[model samples]
Target: MKEFMTNNDYHDIGFNGPNYTWCNNKEGLARIWERLDRIWLNSKSIMDLSNAVVKHLPRISSDHCPILLQIENKKMHNNREIRFKNMWCSYEVAKGIIAKS
Candidate 1:
């Protein structure tokens, strides 16, 4: 899997979700089921790759449920308040306010 990911230029968020999905069903010999579904993404396609995460959802009739991805990135409007205030005021008031402040 690592080799395949590397070949495809994909970055792995690492193994997440259920470990095993299939189990042998037999009498006297009991078997437990596990998770098998996983998620992956391209390294170049993601920003702040370290902030990306995966979570497993509840399993239904299928052996594996869907995986959820949470990605974080730098806020585009980090200084939106300042920009909004500037836009709200005219040049004369802005100059006066700046001078007073």
Candidate 2:
């Protein structure tokens, strides 16, 4: 796994909340906990999503905890269309610019 990650320039982003993501539903010494899940990203992804965070959610009905990846300070809605006014054709400069295009 380490070799694969190194070759692909991927890194463990780490996590918040619980330290362990997996656990045995046993009592006392019979119980065990381990970090079996992880979140990884490549160098470009790390830079592109600098605000990204990993969080370990509660273990509900399953032995493994759910992980959440959150990205802050991002614009979620960017589907606005660029509209050009037909009135621009009335101006000499706009006509010159439009002709150049």
Best by lDDT: 2
lDDT per residue for candidate 1 within 17-86, as digits (tens), equals: 5655444444564766655555667766665476777766556665456677877775567554543466
The CA lDDT at 49 in model 1 is: 71
Model 1 lDDT at residue 30: 75
Candidate 1: which stretches are off by over 4 Å?
A: 15-35, 73-101
Cα lDDT, all candidates: 0.62, 0.92
Steric clash pairs (candidate 1):
18-35, 20-34
TM-score attained by model 1: 0.45
Query: Ten-residue segment with the worst summed lDDT in candidate 1?
Result: 20-29
Model 2 alpha-carbon drift over 4 Å, by segment: 74-101
TM-score, each model? 0.45, 0.69
Q: Give the per-residue lDDT digits (tens) of candidate 2, residues 1-101.
A: 89999999999998899999999989999999999999999999999999899999999999999999998877799697967789999998899888775
Q: Residue 28 of candidate 2: its Cα lDDT?
A: 95
